[model samples]
Target: MDGLGNYLAPDHRRCDDYFSAAEAAALQGEWEAAEAQFNHFLAGMQHHFAKEETVLFPAFEQSTHLTGGPTEVMRMEHAQMRGLFQDMQQALASRDANAYAGAAETLLILMQQHNLKEEQMLYRMCDQMLVRESAELIARMNAIAQ
Candidate 1:
């Protein structure tokens, strides 16, 4: 079942919306608005990562007896992407458009690739190997953990 992945897709879409807006804002030279949008993107993506890392991924690992599975790669990517996001935030805060633009480009690429990987690979694998576990993971991830 793709239950968990389906549930999480909204989180990815929300991130997409923010980043897309950031890109548009940057193009229009709306620096402060772009920065604000990027900040919103950062917080949302971080929350999305937390739901996966702390709940969905761990639960899938537990249910399927898989350690250092696909989630490991995702977690690593999250850290790297987050580092870039932090750099972007700092540059934006300092009103350094040159730095912010470069970082923003990097973030766009990272989010696109990361979201693709999760939706196409990791989540699909989880759906196959942890079908029964999806419901349980979803409940815990969206509820008690919140």
Candidate 2:
């Protein structure tokens, strides 16, 4: 009912939870569990990115006609996170705890910053500017598989 922030903020938390679980497992040298948890985290993150890039950003751009604004910044940040994801994936494949930990630390910082921006600014803008379309927009986001 609150719109974009209501929908996406919880998703950020869900993905962070998976990320934390994966990191904890890796730190404990639980490779099998770490892999499973990391896979979940990765999939969740990819889905979130897809929804924003495909659905939310486009809608926001069309409504606001602000193509070169916060959404653009968020897109770039997404690319950075994807690169980190690749690093984490490679470390996970090798079961390298040290490498994974290093990547995870960077990723955690990136994600926290990114989520704060979305929750505090971008999502609020979407909620206000796209009020009429909020329900359908949120429904579309929800339909994305985690």
Candidate 3:
């Protein structure tokens, strides 16, 4: 958790684990567990996105002075994922497993792609460019309201 990738990548996995648990519970017809797990997953995702959008991305943009670059793309992708989150939430509320499955599938794919870009490119750039500010940046990100 010392570097951007080190911290953020593990967060991604944590969210994914929650997602998997929710999906498994739904598949097993455990509605209560599914709802609980889905809530945890949703909260984890929103918090992660907030940390990046409010802290990491801003720091990267300011340090590099490249506002219309990776951060912009990531923001767009975040919006897209938020839409899927709504869809999944609606499906869960209605206990519609099929609809949830579809939305979850789309979200899973998007998350995989998004995480790859952040881990492989954006994080590496942040690590190199913001090495001096890494500690402060991570602290700010961690301080974001959950």
Candidate 4:
């Protein structure tokens, strides 16, 4: 489960699928299913974030001694993403279809673009510079995720 080659791409697809499912469910007025799928999507996101934040990002930081790298930006963006997710959760809780749909659309864009950047640039950096230090932990995290 290489980060750039397989793991990250697959994770991107999983997120895409969940977001699609959630959107469809919401469009169909299946509020419960939509809510469930959204929750599941959030959980999946958190899991991947954990691997990056705890293992991959730390590996980069330790190797380069540079804190304000892509990972730092990613983490800050994650906090913003979480705020959006929280709003989505509240919308879901209230069964506000309009709000939920809007938030979901925004989140879909945010996550997709974020994943693209990491896969294209940041993950490549990890592979090039920190692969030896990061390889084992990243693989282990991916394994546990699967």
Candidate 5:
């Protein structure tokens, strides 16, 4: 890949694809399909977050010494997204499509906003500031388990 954005930006789209598939299945009342897709989506997202929190963000922080800047905001947003995941899980477990839809809508909005910021700002920052370490950082990110 080109670098940080090249590796991680596609992941954002992959996760979005999973998220959309799961939501579509859920909205259609296809509980089994929804469960399968949601599980996949959840696992992917958790892995993505771990890669960022453990590998990418730490590298950025060390390189830039800006620990409490964008990374901190991203961590908070990750927490918020995790909470939404919980709500979605509970709604799925209960077979409450309406509840799931509500949560999914909120999640979709949040995710779009969050992904935009990361793609436009954070990943660009990483690409610029960590150019020398890009390959190592990408390898570490790729090594993270889903």
Candidate 6:
């Protein structure tokens, strides 16, 4: 059976792929293609965030009996990313490559740091502390509506 990290880490990569594709399209000034790819990336990110926020984080908090630790930090970071998402969306709507690049660069940095924390620390801790509940928690995450 896969642990939390094993199950969730692949999603980060999947989302990254869409993000890269969107960036490539935008760089080429292919607004149609960029819009489609950006939408895919946005949906992927929103879905991933939903899985963590709704399922994994809640379970981790319940198990650890602490609400003001890693999960809180992750939530705050998620909000920051959401704001950047809006900026990117607006840039896309305007076909403003400069704005898009600026927002994407910021988002990319935040995502890298955020993913590192989740992959290196939070997921590992979840795998250990919630080992017995890993399957159930993953199942719940999977069931979340995109």
In candidate 6, residue 140 scores what lDDT? 90
- Model 3 Cα lDDT, one tens digit per residue, 5-104: 8988988999999999999888787889999999999999999999999999999999989999989999999999999999988988999999988999
lDDT value, candidate 6, whole model: 0.93
lDDT of 4 by residue, 17-83 (tens): 8878887887788989988898788888888777778777887788788898778999987887899
Order of all candidates by lDDT, from best down to worst? 3, 6, 5, 2, 1, 4
Which runs in model 3 stand beyond 4 Å of their true positions? none
Q: How big is the positional error of residue 30 in model 2, measured in Å on the Cα after superposition?
A: 0.5
TM-scores for all candidates: the values are 0.87, 0.95, 0.97, 0.89, 0.97, 0.97
CA lDDT, candidate 2, residue 48: 91
Query: What's the lDDT for all of these models?
Result: 0.80, 0.92, 0.93, 0.79, 0.92, 0.93
Candidate with more favorable, higher TM-score: 2 or 4:
2
Model 6 per-residue lDDT at 39:
93
- Where does candidate 4 stray beyond 4 Å? 1-5, 142-146
Stretches > 4 Å off in candidate 2: none
Error of 6 at 144 (Å): 1.3
All models, RMSD in angstroms: 2.2, 1.1, 0.9, 2.1, 0.8, 0.9
Across residues 32-137, which tens digit of lDDT does each residue of candidate 5 receive?
9999999989998999999999999999899989888999999999999999999999999999999999999999999999999999999999999999999998
User: What's the true lDDT of residue 3 in model 6?
Assistant: 90
How does model 3 score by TM-score?
Answer: 0.97
- Among all windows of 10 consecutive residues in model 6, the one with the lowest summed lDDT is 19-28
Better structure of 4 and 5 per TM-score: 5
